[model samples]
Target chain A: MRFDKDSLWYPGIGFAVAGLLLAFGQRALNRYSQGMQRSALWVEHTYDVIRTIESLSSAVSRASANRRAYQITGEPSYILEHRHSAADAHSALAALRDLTRDSAFQQKNVLRLEDLVGARLSVMDDLLKAQARGGLDPRKSASLMARARTLDTRIHGLLTSMTRYEEGVLQLRAEEGQIGYRRTRILQYALTMASGLIILVILLRLSKEIADRQKKELDLRNSTVLMEVVIEGSSDSVFVKDAESRYLMMNTSGAKMIGRPLDGIIGKTDSELFSPETFARLKASDQEIIQSGRPKVYEYSVALPAGTKTFQSSKAPYRDPQGKIVGVIGIARDVTAQKAAEEKLQEAAQIKADFAAMVSHELRTPLTAIKLVIDMIVDRTLGPVNEEQNSALVTAQRSIDRLSRLINETLDFQKLESGKMEFRVSEADVNRLVQEVVISFEPVAKGRSITLLTNVAKDLPKVRCDKDKITQVVTNLLSNALKFTAGPITVSTAMDGSDVRVSVKDSGPGVSPEDQTRLFQSFVQLEGTRSIQGGTGLGLAISKKIIERHDGKIGIQSKVGDGATFFFTLPVDRSA
Target chain B: MSPKRRILIADDDPDILAMLSLRLLKAGYDVVKAAEGSLVLALVRETKPDLVILDYFLPNVKGDEICLQIKADSALRAIPVILLSASTAALPPETVHAIPTDDRLTKPFDISILLEKIRLLLPAESAG
Candidate 1:
C-alpha cells in the first residue's frame, strides 16, 4: 500500500503539469471566442452605417424631385410629398448621426452632411414662397431657379463625400473582421495543439500507471495461488499462527492434522483445537520463536485413529516487509514408522549380543575341561607316553587352543558391537610387541618351510594401547600370512608420521580389490581364504575392532598379482 | 622332619577335579579332591591343606565366597586360596581387594605354568 517517493511523486508532477496546460488552453480558447464575437459585432455595425447613409442619399434625391415639381405646378400635394421626403431624409440623417455617435471622425462627416441638406431645403422653400406671391417676371424667376440649382449641386457634392466616407469605413471594418478571424483561428489551433499535447501526456501516464498496477496485482494473485498450491500439495503439515497465538493460515494438510476443515481451524487458537496440555506446550514454543527470532524444532508422539505416530516439527519466526516479527510458521512430518524401525533394529542387535555371550560362555565351559585334560596328558603327569602319543596329545592341545581363541573372538565381537569393549591403555614398545607375536608364529612358519622375517625399526616409538588386544591383532595378521604364503613372510615395524605402524607382508596370492573392501567385516571370508585353514572368519573382524578401539587404522594394500601387506597403525604416544 | 605338602582341588566337573588331582599327585604333592563346592570348605578345614584351588562357578558357594569365608577364619586365612574362572573379566573391586585371596587364575591354564605359579606361592610347602 505504501509507495516510494519517486513512484508517488513522478506521476503527480505529470498530472499537475497537464492540469496547468489544460487550464491555460481553456483560458486562451475563451479569449479567442470573445475576440471573434466582438469582431462579428464590429462587422455588423459597419454594414448598418453604410445602409443608413445610402437611405439618406435616396431620401434627399426624392425631396429635391418633389420640391421642383411643386415649383412648376404649384401643387400642394407635391409640397406635402416634398415635406415627407425631407422628413425621411432628416430621420435617416439623424439615424446616421446616432450610429456614428461613438466615432469622432464619422460624427464630423455627419454634421457637414446635415448642414448641406438644410441649405438645399431652405433654397427650395424660398422659391416656393416667390411662386406663391404672384407670377413674377420671367427674368426674376430664372434668377431664382438658377440660385436653387447652384445650392442643389453643392448638396449632391456633400452627399457623395459622405457616401464615399461610409464606404471607406465599411471596407476597413471588413478587413478588421478578416484579421480578427485569422487571429481567432490561430488561437484555436494553438489551443487545440496544446490541449492535445497535454491530453496525450496525461493519457500516456495514466495508461502506464494502470498497466503497471494491473501487472503487480496479477503477479500477486498468481504467486498467492502458487503458494496455496504448493502448501496444499505437500504431505507435511504447514501452518501460520499470529502473535495472539491464533491460527492465521493453515493448508489442507495442517487442517487435516487437526482433524478439521480449514474454515473450522482458521482463527482458532490451539486451546480451542488441541488439548490444554498441547496448547500450553505450543504456546510456549510460539513465544520462544517470536522472542528469539530463531527456529525451534521438537518431536512428539500422538495417538490417532491409525496408531501412535511420532512427528518432528520445526517453527520459525514469520516477519513482515519491515522485518517486524509477526507470527510463527511451521511444518511437521511423520516419523512414526522410522522410529519404530529403529527400535526393532536395536532390539534385534541386543538379542544377538546376548546370544553371542551365552554361546561363548557355554562353549568355554566344555572347552576348559577338554583343555585341562589335554594339558594333563601332554604334561606326562598321568603317565609317560610314546613320542607319537605325545605328539598326538599336543595336536589335541593345539586344537583346543584354536577352539578357545575362536570363542574369545566371538565374545570380543559381541562386546565391541555393544560398545562395551574396555581398553586398559598402557605404554608399550611397538617393536618388541611385534617381535613377540612374530616369534609365536615362527614354529608354524618353519613347518611350512617359510621364512619369518622381523624388521624392527630402531628407536621405534611406543604407543598407548591394550597390550593383549594389540597382541591379538598382530597374531591374527601373522597367522593369516603364514596360512596363505609359501614364500618368506616379513613382519615390519616403522614410525609413520604421528602413528606407529606394524605390518605383516606375505608373498602369497594377494587379495583382489573387490574382496579387500569387505575383508574386515564379520563373516566375510575372502574366496581365497578357507575353512580348512582353520579360520573362524572372526579374526580380522576382531582385529579391526581392537585397532579402532585403540584409535588406529587397519587395512591392506595390494593388487591381484602383488603379494599382500596387512597393516595397522596406532597413534604414537605424544607425552614423550 | 617337615610334613609332606597337601593340596586341595575343587570343581563342579568331576573329570576336571580327577585330572587336576592326578597331575598334582604326580608332581609329588599329596592331593585331596572335592567334586562339589559344598565339600571344599569342610575338606579344607579338616585337611588343613597347604594350598586350595577353587572354581568360581561352584554349586553351593562361589570361589570368591569361599575366599571370603577363608579370610573370615583367621586359622585358614593364611592358607593360599587361588580362585579360578573361565572369563578374564576383572573381579568386582570389593571382591578383588576386600576378600583379596592369595591369587586368581584363568581356567585352561598351562600345566607347567600353573605348577610354577603354585610353587612360587607355596615355596616352602611344595619344596618338600
Candidate 2:
C-alpha cells in the first residue's frame, strides 16, 4: 500500500506501532531482569543452607575433640570448651532447618540433622556427667566411653548424610538458576533485536519521506522561478488583483506603467494608487470582469509621470485552482506611439489630398478657359477659320480634353485613396446605362473606323450604384478600347448570379498575365501602352475603386493574341 | 428679339470670365460679367438677368454663399442659377442638389452643354 506521507495518520500510526513495540520490549526486559534477580536470590538461599549444614558438622566434630581432651587431661577449662562447642553445633543445625524450610525434601533432611545434632550433644553431656563422678573404676569409665562412641558414630553418620543432602540441594538450586538466567537472557536479546528492527524501519521510512518532500519542494521552487522570469521579462504590464480589487502581485512593467515602485503598488487598491476618477473607472471595469467571469479588451489613456500615454489593456477574470473568480489578470500594452503614428499618417494623407485638390482646381481654371476659347475658334465663332487652322485647333482641343481627363483621374484617385470619395448611390438600370455610354462612344469609334456595339442582356436586374461613377467606368473602358484597337468594341451587360456584369470586349493586343496583375495599380501604365498612348494610368485604378465601393468586382481576362475583355460586376439592387 | 435674354457670369479668372461671356454672346444672349465675387450680387440685382452662372470658388466670397443669398432674396430667387466648380470632389452631386440651383456643372465642360442647361432654365420664348 502506498502511504500518504503528508497524512498525520501514517507517521502517527507508525510511531504508535513503534512505541507499542518498545513498550512491549521494555516490559520483556523488565521481566527478564526481575527473573534473573529472583533466580540469583534463590541460588544465594541454597548456598546459605549448604554453608549452615557444613558449619553444623564442623561444630559437632570440634565438640567431640574437646570432650576427649577433657577426659584425658581432666581439666575444667576443657569441659567448658566442650559445652560451648555443643551449643554452637545446636544453633547451626537450627539455622540449617530454617534455611531449608522452603523445600519439603530439604526440610525433612534438616529435621533429621537437628535430631542427630541433639543426640550427639546429649551423649557428650552423659560423658561429662560420668567424668564428674571421678571415683569410678576404669571398667565403669570404659563402658560410659563406649556408649558415647556409639552415639558419636551415629551422630557422624547422620551429619555426613545431612551435609550430602544439603550439597545436593545447593547443586539443584544452581542448575535451576542457570536455566532461568539463560531463558531471561534469551528473552532480553530477542526483545532488543525486535525493538531495534522496528526503530530502524521507522527511521528509514521517515528519511525517505523527507527526501521525497525535499525533491518536490525543489521542483516547486524551480517552477516559481521560471514563472517569475516570464512575468518580469515582459515589456507589457502584467498584474493580478485580489478579490477586494487590491493589487496582489505586479510585475516591474506594471509598476512602471502606474508610475509607482513595485512595493508601493502591491497590496494597494486602485483608489490608493490612481486619481479618484481613474480609480472609479478601473474599479468598475475590474468588478464587472470579476463578477461576469469574462475577459475584456479596452483602450484607455492615463497621464503618467512621463506624459499622457494610451494603453490597450486586455483583462480576464483571474480564477483560482477550483475555478472561482478571485480577481483579474491584465496585460496592458502602451499604444501611444502606434496611435500617434496612425494620426500622423492620416494628417499626411489629408495634406496630400488637399494638394491634389488645389492643383486640380488651378489647372482646371486655365484648361476651362483654353477649351472655351478653342471650341469657339473651331466652331468659327471668333472669325472664319481655314480648313488647316480648324484641324490644328481641333487637335489642340483634343489635347486639352486629354489634359482635363488626366486632371480628373488624378483627383478621383486622390479622393479614393484618402477615403473622401462620396458616392451618391441610387438604383440604376445597367442595360440603359451601358447603351448610353456606348452611344456616346459611337462618334469616337466611328472616327476610328471601329464599330461600337451594345450587346445588353434582356430583363437585366438594376444595380445599386453611383450612376455617374459607373458611367465614368464604362466611358473609360470604351475610350481605352477605342484608343488601343480599331477592331469593333462591344459593350455587353448581363446577369451573373445576383450581380449585373458589364463587359467591354475589344480586339486589342491582349494584356499579358504579368501586366494584368498590376494593371489596376495607380500610376502603372504598361510598357508598350505608355509610349503608344499618352494617358494618366489612374483610369483603371479609379474604376476599380469605384466598382469595389459598390461592392462589385473588376478584372480583365485575356491571353496573348486573343482579344481582351474588361469586365465588372455590380451587385443587383436586391432591396428593390 | 426678347431684349437678348441677359445672363450674368461671375468668375475670379479673367480668361474664364472673358471666354464664357464671348461664348454666351455668340450664342445670342446678352452677357453681364463680374471678375470678382463681390460684384456678382450687385450685377444680378441690377441686370435682373435671365440666368446667373457662378464660379464656386472666388475671391472675397464663395459661390454657394452668393447662390444661397440669391435664393434667399425674393426678387432674385426666380432667376436661374448654374454653379460651376473646378473641384468636383468638394462639391459632389449630392451637395449640388442640396444647394438650390437650377443646375451644377464641373469646370472644363463642353460649351454646348452649358448652353443647353441655360436654355432649359430660361423660358422657351426668352431663350437665345
Candidate 3:
C-alpha cells in the first residue's frame, strides 16, 4: 500500500511500529537471556559449591583423623595431612565465593561455609596439640574429634543449601526464557502473516479497480466510436480542433466537405488546409469562440474541389472540468440547394419585372401610333369616309379592341408572375358584378351577332373581394367564351357552400380533355377549330392566379359539341 | 416675321430622333439633333436652343450628368431640357427638372401629354 502521511497506512508509521516491536522483542529476549545467563552462572557456582563442600567434608574428616594420629604418636604424616586438608579447604572456599558474585544467599552461605572450615581447622589444631602432649588419652581425643566433626557437618550443610538455592534460580530463569522465546515466535509469525494478508488484499483490490477502470475506458471508446459514426453520416460537417487550432479530428463528411482526405486534414491547421482569406476568417472565429466561450454561427461561401459551396457554420469552444477552454468544436451544414432556390426565385422575379417593363414599352409604342391614327380617322383628319369605309372602320375598331385585351392579359400575367399583383378588397354585390361584366361583352357579342345572356341570382351573396379585379376576371372568362364560341354565351352566378360561383357557358367546340389539363398554364393555347382571333394565351393563366390570390378557385368543363363552361368561385361575405 | 423657335432633341435611338424631328418640323420649329453622349454639350454650346429634349439613357454620358453639366453652365442653363426614357429608372424628376429643364417626360408618352409639356415649357404665343 502506498503511504498516507496522516493515515496509519503511512509507510514510516508502519515501519516505526515494526521497529518498536522488534526492539521491544529483542530487548525482552535480551533481558530474558541475561536473566537465564545470570541464573546459569549461579547454578554452575552452586554445583561447584556442592563439589567443593563434598571435598571440604572429605578434607575435614581426613584432617580430624590425622590430628588424632598426630596427638597420639607425634608422626610427621599427620602434620602433612593436616596441612594438605587445610590448603584444599581454603581453595574450595575461595572458588565458591567467586561464583557467588550476584547471589547474596550463595555468597553468605559461602562465607558461612568458609567460617566453619576455619573453625574446623582450628579445632583440628587443638586436637593435634593434645595428641602431641598427652599421647593417646581417650577423654581428650573424644573432645577434639567431637568439636571438628560438628564444624565439618555445619559447613557441609551450609554449602548444600547454597547449591540448592542456585538451582531454584536456574529453573526459574529457564522457564522465563521459554516463555520469552514462544512470545517472540508468535509475534513474528503474526506480523509476517498480517503483512502478507494486507499486501494480498491490496493487490486484489488494486487489480479489480484496474479492471473496472479499463471497462470504463472501453465504454468511453465505444461512445467515441458511436459519435464518430454519427458525425460521419450526418449531412453536416463536424470537426474538433486542439487549443493550438490544429485539427485533432474530423468526420468523413467534414473532410469530404472541405475537399480534403481525412489523413490530410487530421493534423493540419486552417492556414495549412484552407486558403489565406478563409484561414484568416476561421482563425478570427476560433479566437472569438476561445475568448468568449460562446458559440458563433455564420454563413460562408467557399470554393472547393467539388464546386462552390455555401455553408451555415456554427463553432463552439470545448471546455473541461475546470471550465478551461480546451479546444473548438464546429459543425457546418451545406446550403447549396437552398441558396440556389433563393437565387432562382430572385431571378424569376426580376425577369418578371423586366418583362412587364418591356411589354409596356414595346406594346404601347405601336398601340399609341395606332390609337393616334384611329383618333385622326375618327376626327375626320384623314378625310371624310364613305359608308363602306365607315363599316371597315368598325372592323378596325374590333381588331384594336382585341389588341387592347391581349395587352391587358400580358400585363396581368406579368403582374402575377412577379407576385406584384395588389388586390383591393371590398364588399361587392355578386349579381350586379356579374351583370356588369356580362354587359361589357354585349357590344362584342352583338357585333358578332351571338346571343349573350346573364342568369345572375337575385339573392346571390355579396362577395368580399377586389370588385374591379373580380370584374376583370369575369370579363376575361366571358370574352374567352365569345372569342371561342360561334353561337351564344350564357353568364350565370350561383351560391356554392361558402363561395359564390360564376360560370360563363358558351355554345362552341369545347376545349379537349388533354388541353383542359394544361389550359391555365401560361402561353398554352389549345390547338382547336376555334379561331384565336389574335389572342395572347395568358388570359386563363392570369385569371387563375387572380382567383388563387383571393383564396378562390377556377375550373372549366366542356364536351366537344355541348359547349364549354368556365367557372370560378369566391368566398361569400362572412363579415356581414 | 417672328424667328423660328429653336429646339434641341437628344436621344440614343436614331429612330426616336427622326420621328421627333418630323413631328417638331411639322410643328414649325427649328430642330437641332445629337445622337451621341459627347456631341450633346458641344451642340448645346454652339446652338443655344430655346428647348432641349434629352433621353435619360445614353451611350457614353449619363443623362443626369449631362443635365447637371448643362445646368451648371451659366450660358446654356436657361434653356428648358426635357428628359425622356423608356423606364423611369429611378431618376429623380425634381432634380432633373430642377436642372433648368422645364420638364421630364417618360417614353411611350402620350403625344397629347408631350404636346402639353412642350406648350407648357414655352410662352403661350411663342409655342405656335
Candidate 4:
C-alpha cells in the first residue's frame, strides 16, 4: 500500500499500522516457535532424566539377580555379568545427576538413589571377596545377601520416586507448549484481520479519489469543447481580453477580422492588432465596460480594400466564477451592406419627394388656368352661354376639380410621409364648424340625390385641434361617405369621455373584412358595392395623418351589406 | 359712378392676369394689370387703384415681400392686397403671421370667391 493525499494521513497511517501488524505477527510466530522449542527440550530433558533413573533402577535389579545366581552356583561368568551391571548402574546414576542439575528436588532424589545403589554394590563386593578365598562361608554369604537386599529395596523406592517426578515434568512441559501454540494462532488471526481491514479501507479511499478527480476533469474538458464549438460556429467575431488588456481568446471570425492566425492574436494587446487611434478608442470602451460592469454597444466604420465597412460592436464585462469583473468580452457584427442599403433608401425617398413637389407645382398652374377659363364661361363674364354649353362646362369643371383634388392629396400624403406636415392647433367651435361644412356640401349632396342629415350635439365640448386640418379630415370623410352613398347620410357629433366623437354614417356598400385592414394606408380604394367613383385613394391616408397629428383616433365599423359608420375622436380641450 | 373705382392685379401667369383683369373690368371697375412684382407697385402708383391683387410668387420679388412694401409705404398701404400662390405649400404659421396681407388664397380659386373678397375690401359705394 502507498500513501494518499486526499485522505491526508490515512494511507500513511494505514500502511504503518499494517507494517506493525506484520512485525507483531512475525514476532509472535517466532516467539511461539521458540517457546515450543524450549517446551519440547524440557519434555525431552524430563524424558531423558526419567529414562536414566529407570535404567539405573533396572541395572541394580539385574546386578542383584546375577549376584544371587553367582552365590547359588559360584559361576565366574555370572560374577562378570554382576560387575558389568554394577558399572552400568554407576554411569546411569551420574547421567541422572546431570539431567536434574537445575531442580533441587530431583537432585536430592538422585543423590539418595545413588547412595543406596553404592551400598548394595559394596555388600555384594564383600561377599564376592570372601567367596574368592576358596573357603565355604555360607553364613557370611547369607549375611551379605541380606544387607544387599535391604539396600536394593531402599534404592528401588528412591528410583521409583525420581522416575515419577521426571514423568510429571515431561507432562507439564507438553501442556505449556500446547498453550503457546493456541495463543500464537489467536494472535495471528487478530492481527491479520485488522491489517486486512485497514488495507481495504485505504484501497477503497484511493479508488474513489481517482474516480472523482477523473470525473471532474472530464466535465471541465467537455465544457471547454462545447464552448469552443459555439464560439467558432457563430458568424460574429467573439473576442475576450484579460484584466491586463491582453487577448486571452479569439474565435475564428475574430482572428479573421484582424487577418491574423490564432497564435498571433492570442496574448496580444489591442494596440498590436488595431491601429493606434482605433486601439485607444477600443481600449477606453473596454475599460468602461470592465470597470463599470456594464455592456457597451457602438457602431464603427473601417476602411478596407472593398471601400469602407461598418460594424456594430457589443462589449460586456467578463466575470470570473466569483462574479468579479475581470475583463471584457466583445462581439462585433459586420453591418456594411445594411448601412449602405439604408442610405440608398433614404436618398430615394428624398428624390421621390422632390419629384412629386415639382410635378404638383407644374400641374397646378395649368389646372388653375383651365379652371379659371371654365369659371369665366360659367360666370357668363365673356359672353352669355347656352344651356347645353353651360352643362358641358360644368361636367368638365367637375372632372377638373377631381383631378385637382387627386394632385393635392398626393402631395399632402408625400409631405406627411416626410414628416413635414404643419398643423395649427387651436380651440375651435367644432359644432358650428361642422354645421357650416355640411351646409356647404348640401348643394353637392342634393345634386347627387343623397340626403345629407346632420345631428350636432348641443353643448358639445370644444376640442383642441388644427381647425383647417380637422376640417379637411371631416370633409374628406364626408365626401367619401357621399361618394359611395346615396341613401340618407348622417353626420353626428357627441361628447365621448375626454374626446369629441364625430361620425359620418353612410348607407353605402360596406367594405370587406380584408379591405378594412389597410383602409387608411395610402392608395387603398375599397371596391365595395358602390361603383368606383374615382378618388386619389390618398384621401383616407391624409385624413388619418391629420387626425393622428391632432392626437385623435379614426376608425370605421361596418358589416357586409350594412351601412358604414366612419368615426373619429378628437381630444377635447380639457385645459379649460 | 366715381369714374368706376380703380383696381390693380399682378400675376406671373398671363392667362390668370388677363382673366382677373377681365373679371374686374366686367364688374365695372377700372382694371390695371402687371405680370411682374415690380410693375404692380408702379401700376398702383400710376392708377391709384382702390385694391391690388398680387400673386404670392412673381418674376423678381415675392408676393409677401411686395405686400410688405405696399403696407410699409404710406401711399399704397390703404390699398388692400390679396396674395395668391399656385404651389400648395402653405406657409408656416410663424411666417404667415409675419407677412402683411388682407387675404390669402390658393390658386385655381373660385372666381366668385375672389369677387366676394374684392367686394368686401372696397368701399360700399365702389363695391355697388
**Candidate No. with top lDDT:** 2
Tell me the lDDT of model 1 at B126. Answer: 33
Ten consecutive residues with minimal summed lDDT in candidate 1 chain A?
A: A300-309
Per-residue alpha-carbon lDDT of candidate 1 for residues A62-107, written as tens digits (9 for 90 to 100): 8878877987887899999988988998998899899999889888
lDDT of 3 by residue, A1-576 (tens): 332345335444555666665666567667656766876775676567667667766776777777667656778987998889778878867876776766787777777777888888887777666655755477766877787667766776775676567667667766876786688667766766665565566666667766887788899999999887788788788889988789988888888788888999998898997778888888888888999999989788877778888898899998888989999999988998999999998998777677676766566556545644554465455569778877787677667666766666676677676676666678889888888877777887888999998888768767789887888889878878877888889999988887999999998888778888999988877765335565577878888998988889999999877889999998775442
Candidate order, TM-score descending: 1, 2, 4, 3
Better of 1 and 4 by TM-score: 1
Candidate number with greatest DockQ: 2
Cα lDDT of model 2 by residue, A1-576, tens digit: 244646556667767776776777678678767876876787677667767766777788889899889888998898888888888888887787787777787777767766766776776777778778764467866776687677667766766676677667667766876786677667767766776777787788878877887888888899999989999999999999987889998899889888888999999998898778878888888988988899999788777788888999899999999999999999999999999999999888878977898899999999999999999898888999999999999889879988998998888888888888888878898898888888887777777789888898999876778899999999888877776777888889888888889999989888899989999988888755655557798989999999998888999999877879999998875442
DockQ for each candidate? 0.34, 0.58, 0.11, 0.45
Question: Tens digit of lDDT per residue, candidate 3, span B5-122?
Answer: 8888888766667666666666678999988888889999998888888877676996777887998899977777787765532233345445544577654555557767887786
| Residue A548 in model 1: lDDT | 82
True contacts kept of 4: 0.59
Which ranges in model 1 have alpha carbons more than 4 Å from their true place? A1-26, A71-73, A76-94, A101-341, A423-436, A439-449, A454-471, A493-502, A526-532, A545-553, A569-576, B1-128
| Candidate 4 lDDT tens digits, A148-227 | 77787788777777777777777777787788789898998889888888888888987897788788778889998998
Fnat: each model in turn: 0.39, 0.82, 0.11, 0.59
- The number of the candidate with the highest TM-score is 1
True-vs-predicted CA distance for residue A337, candidate 2, Å: 2.1
The TM-score of candidate 1 is: 0.74
| Residue A245 miss distance in model 2 (angstroms) | 5.1
